[model samples]
Structures are given as structure tokens and as C-alpha cells.
Target: MINSVSIVPDFFQRVKTISFPEVIRVFYDEEPRRSKIHCPFHEEKTPSFHIYENGFFCFSCGEKGDSIDFIVKLYNLRPINAAKLIAERFGLPVSNGPLSRQDMLRLARAKAERLREKRLKEAFDNWARLAGQQVRILAEAIRLQLEEKGLDIEEDLLPLVHELPRLEWWANILAEGTGEEKLELFRNKDFRRWFTCKN
Candidate 1:
């Protein structure tokens, strides 16, 4: 039998290091929050499988794991699969049991490069999400202001008016804003420029 006790430390350490989202894409659909996705290992219509970022636990079956446990459970794979899967997705190579010090350093460098790319992607997505939210709030505010001023437009006018400044009110607000005021300054370009310059 595999010595679970002896491997626990290594197992957990590897899991901690592996990128969770990349693993989900291998056996599960791209989107995990869909409440269901077609299980690759079986045929079903309702898609009872759900993959979380940290792990996957099928409601239909009790298969679950961090990335390593995931590969093993799904394909009857071993730690080798765990290493290979991570390396393949991350574009690193599996480690040979016997490596010279130079080879070991190369593996470490590859792993680090993979990790940095993952982090950059995550940060970009987060920035996009936040930026999108700010744009939405600004659009809503402009719509309300235009309506209040009796400046009505058809649906087609949305694109044209979105980029126009109704007034510099948001900028003025930001100029003397408290902490909350500064946080909401994304709606105003002048304020954004001012803040950027000031900083």
C-alpha cells in the first residue's frame, strides 16, 4: 500500500504550489460556477460535476482532490500524472528522478516562469473586472444625469454620449474628496489624470 503518512508533506506542498485553475480546465469545463458541466469520465445530460478552484467534488460521484488528487482519481493516475499534468499545462517538464544540480536549477527556473505567467494573468483579469465595474457605475450615473436635465436620447445615442463629459462635477468632487470620494473617482477622467499626476 502507498504510505499516505510519509507522502503527506510532499503531497500538500505540491498541491500548494500547483495552479488550481489550470487543473480544473483539464477534466472540467472552463467555467466552474455554471452549477454543472459535462463529466468527461461519464455520459450524462444534467452535468452533475462541479469543479472549484481549490478542488472538485462531483455531486454524482465523490471524486475530489487538490490538482494531484484530481488527476489520480480521474485517470487512476499517480504522482507522476500529477507532475506531468501540471508541467504540461504550465509548459514545464517533468523532473527526472536523477538530476544534476544544473538540471535541478533549470527545472526550478521553468516552474518559476510558469508561476509568474499565472500570476500576471490573474492580476490582469482582476484589473479588468474592477475597471469594468467602474465604467458601469459611471455609465449609470451619466444616464441619470441626462434624464434629470431633460436630455433624452434613443438607445442608439448610448455609444456617442458615453465618452462625453456632461460636466466636470466628478472631477470637482474628487479634487476635495475624502477617502470615499477618492475611491469613486474612476467615473471622471480629469480626476483620474489629476490623481495620477499628483501621485
Candidate 2:
């Protein structure tokens, strides 16, 4: 069996050394060092989320925690499971218990689930980044297409097309949308075509 007393302190020490904001950024986009982003814990038009060196606090929703707490909240995992994930991610050694067939299968399933979530998060990030870039490119293309057709478009509206609302919309979709919804988004033929094209 694992020695909890000896291993817990070492596990926490290693976890504490990891930068809290850096870990937040891996799962959500945040500006470096005290910049505000939309609170992942609550829905709002304005940003009330703040990340400090030691921890994070959401002003709107009153959510506050350190790195381990953040992982528990983000992943909806129990404390022990979160600890296991952190230990695995950081390559910290955990004292092994005797494995039965069921235990081995459960461990394998958990690892696979984590891997699937990682891949989905990566794909979501990639889609969001490309969508942001495409907004600018598509706007320019539309302006050109309109010009070619001799259509009059307002000058002020041109800048608005590439502004914060577009980005925020995409962020909301990624942050709040279900997995099936995200998959459906990527399945759009136009999006797939654009995603494959060279920039």
C-alpha cells in the first residue's frame, strides 16, 4: 500500500512549485500576470477573473482557490483523483499498491479518459485560434468582394468586424458549449475547408 503521510507532503510541494497562472492558461486563455479574462466559473459580458502568482479568484462568482483546487473545480474530480492526475502529469512518483485485474482496468480507463480530454481541449484551442484569424481574413475578403460588386459599405463598420465581440463569441462557444456542439462546429464543411487551407 502507498504511504500517505510521507508521499502527500512531497506531492503538494511539487504541485506548489508549479505556477498557478501557467496552469490556468493551459486550459483557458488569460493574459499574463493579473490581466482579466471572462470568468470561467460564471457567465458575464465583462471580465472579472483574475489570476495571481499563488492562486486564482473570480470576483463575480466568488470562486477562489489554489492550483489543486482549480484542477478539482475544472475537471469535476474528487481530491484524490485530482492528486493522482497532478502526480501523473508532473511525473511525481506515487507509491504503488498491489494491482488486481479490476484495478488495472480502472487505471487504464482513467488514463484513456484523461488523454481524450486532452486531445479535445487541444482541438478546441486550435479551432478557436484559427477562427480568430479567419475573422480578419474573411472580413477583408468580404470588403474586397463588395468593392468588386460596387456596393457601398460603411467605413466605421469595417473595424467593428474584427473587434472583441467576435472573439468573445468564439470564447463563449468554446467555454460553454457541449462536446457534441464543439464537434458539430468542426464538422462544418466551410470551416473544415478553411482550416485545411494554407494561411
Candidate 3:
């Protein structure tokens, strides 16, 4: 059964970030700032679980979250889990959690997601600008290297030479191929040689 008032501090104060593994540790160990609890996600002893002031990582079963997310994941649960848990523990009738409280959480989550997406977009914008400059520099350097080596440069590769794909696309592409294929696509050996020789 969960406590009526959270023994941990307010969610905001408890952690700046949260992760599953750390929460698991808080559940297990008697950390000074965090509490020891049985990791609900897995079987264990001696409380290898932990939760940060902000509810970050867990050392066991890799269950983690912010206070809310922690609770959700802890139960192998969903957004509705808290409401249900509270209802069950307190012997109250379950009615879709509390409407007002759940709505507030939904709002907070929506706002947070928007902010995260905006921040990510901004970061990508910055990376795009930097990549533009980097691509130019790389292109120029590559051109010079090719020229010095008396190698023919492909005229069609200007775009590819100038900018890396966006991070999302890059991730997708990297994940799309097999290890050997990805290594080949990335020209990993060439990069390694370049880095080693440059140093």
C-alpha cells in the first residue's frame, strides 16, 4: 500500500530527472536522500533499488521515472495506475482515477511534451546551422585533400559533403542497417584513420 502523503519530497524537489534503474535502487538500498523499497519490477534482496530526490535512475530492474512516472512504471502500471492504486489501497471505488487530478496531470504532461519538442527543434536548428558551417569546412578540406592527391572529385556530392542529415533521420538511418552495413555506410575506418593520424 502506498502512503497517503508521499514520504519523499514533492515531485519537483525530489528529482530533476528520473530513470527506472535508479528507482529500483531506492527500493532496495537505504540511501540517505532516497528510500529503500522492494523493486516492484523484479525480484531482489537488500533493496538494490533507489529513487533520487528528482526520481531519476534505478539500479535494479531498470525501472525509473519522475515521481509520477516512477509510480506508473513501478507498478508496471500506466497513467491510470496511481488512481487505481490509491483507490485500492484506500478502499475507494475506482472511477477512472480522479478526473480533475488526472486532467491536471495530462495538462502538465502535454505542456512538458510540447516544451521538450520545442527544445529539441531548437537544438536541431542550432545543429543545422553548425552543420552547414562544418559541411563547408569538411567539403573544402576534402576538396583540398583530393586535389593534393590528384584524385577526381565527384561533382554530384555537394549536398552530401556539406551537411549531415538531421539527428532523427540520422538515427533512423543508423538503426536501419546491419552492423557491417552501418560501418560501411559511415566509412568508420576512414574516420578512425583520420582521427588517429590527426592526433
Candidate 4:
């Protein structure tokens, strides 16, 4: 479940304690004290962004915000992530609220799911690249056969021919500890027929 409040007040308070000018100095070449720098949010030839002791304001875009807001906008981070980044950078404590066992489990499950999805995507991409190479070889063979028969090769046939190996490869990769459904799909007679089709 999502947190009730994405931005924890304590975390924001800690982030606010860090000087905005100090954070700006990390990214900008010029000193931040009343100095003008190009607005990080928008493109401009002149430096219209001014840094104050408390926060920053861009004269060109009318963008004004505090330290946490600056980090969030500059890095394109979520409120919690930005707060955590600020805390980590400034050596401040991260947790603003107590975590229940359910929250811990939920976080763990979410992390595991993300990792699994990433691995599955990588596997699919790798199989796709190999399948594309195989399809090119098949297309060349088909072209040679058509030329021998004094016939024209159809462009649409390439995709139909390629689908079989791609689906088989995808199914095989997904079958590894995924479930019986993928294996069953791979073993279906229609799928097998498609895999073995010459035309």
C-alpha cells in the first residue's frame, strides 16, 4: 500500500536545514549567494535564476521554491525520494515514521517484483535479438528459393514466418520457474504447427 503521506514532515525539516546555496554549488559553476545562473528548469541565454539564503527563484520562469522543492524539480524525483536523497547527502537520518511489519513486507515484495520484471524484460530482449537474426536468415533462404522458382517473395510473409520462433523463444524463456501455463502454451499443438510451418 502507498504511504498515507508521501512527504514526511521530519524528513522535509531535515532537508530544509541543509543550506540551499550549498546544494546549488554542487551543480552550478558560479557562487550561489545572490549570484545569477541559468535556470535549471528552463533554457535561457542569460542567467535569470537567483539563489537566496533560504531558497532559489527564477526570474524568467517565475519558479520559486525551497531546498526540497529545488531537489525534487532539479532531479525529477518523487517527494520521498528527493527527501531521502537530501538526507543521505547531508548525513541526516532517513526515517521519519515507524515501519510496521506489513509495511516492511510490502516494501520487500515491491522490490522483488521490480527485480523480477527487470530480469524478465532483459531475457525477452535478448531472445528478441537472437530471434531477429534467425528471421533474417530465414528471409534470405526464402528469397533464394523464390528466385530459383522465378517467383516474387512477399514482404508480409517475413513477419508471419518470424512470429513462430519469437513466440517459442519467448515461451521457453518465460517457462523457467514462471509457471506451468507457459509450458502448456509452448506444448500446444497449434503452436507446434506454427513453429514447424515451412510456408
User: How badly does each model clash, as a count of residue pairs?
Assistant: 0, 0, 35, 0
Ranking by lDDT: 2, 4, 1, 3
Predictions: Cα RMSD each: 10.4, 8.4, 15.0, 14.8
* Residue-by-residue lDDT tens digits, candidate 3, 9-120: 3322323233333433334333223355555567886565564565555487676656556556655666455435433332333432344765566656755765675686
lDDT tens string, model 2, 1-199? 5667776666676666767765675556554424567877778888887788878888899998887888899889986667677656644444444556765666577668767767877777676556656755655565565566543556665564444354345445545555455466567674465445222
Winner on lDDT (1 vs 2)? 2
Can you list the residue pairs that collide in candidate 4? none
Give the Cα RMSD of candidate 4: 14.8
The numbered model that scores best in lDDT is 2
Q: Give the TM-score of candidate 4.
A: 0.43
Q: Relative to the unseen true structure, what is the C-alpha lDDT of residue 123 in candidate 1, on a scale of 0 to 100?
A: 69
Off by over 4 Å in 3: 1-99, 144-199
The residue pairs that clash in candidate 2, if any, are none
TM-score of each: 0.48, 0.44, 0.26, 0.43
Q: Where does candidate 1 stray beyond 4 Å?
A: 1-22, 25-31, 34-38, 42-55, 65-69, 72-99, 150-199
CA lDDT, every model vs. true structure: 0.56, 0.64, 0.46, 0.63
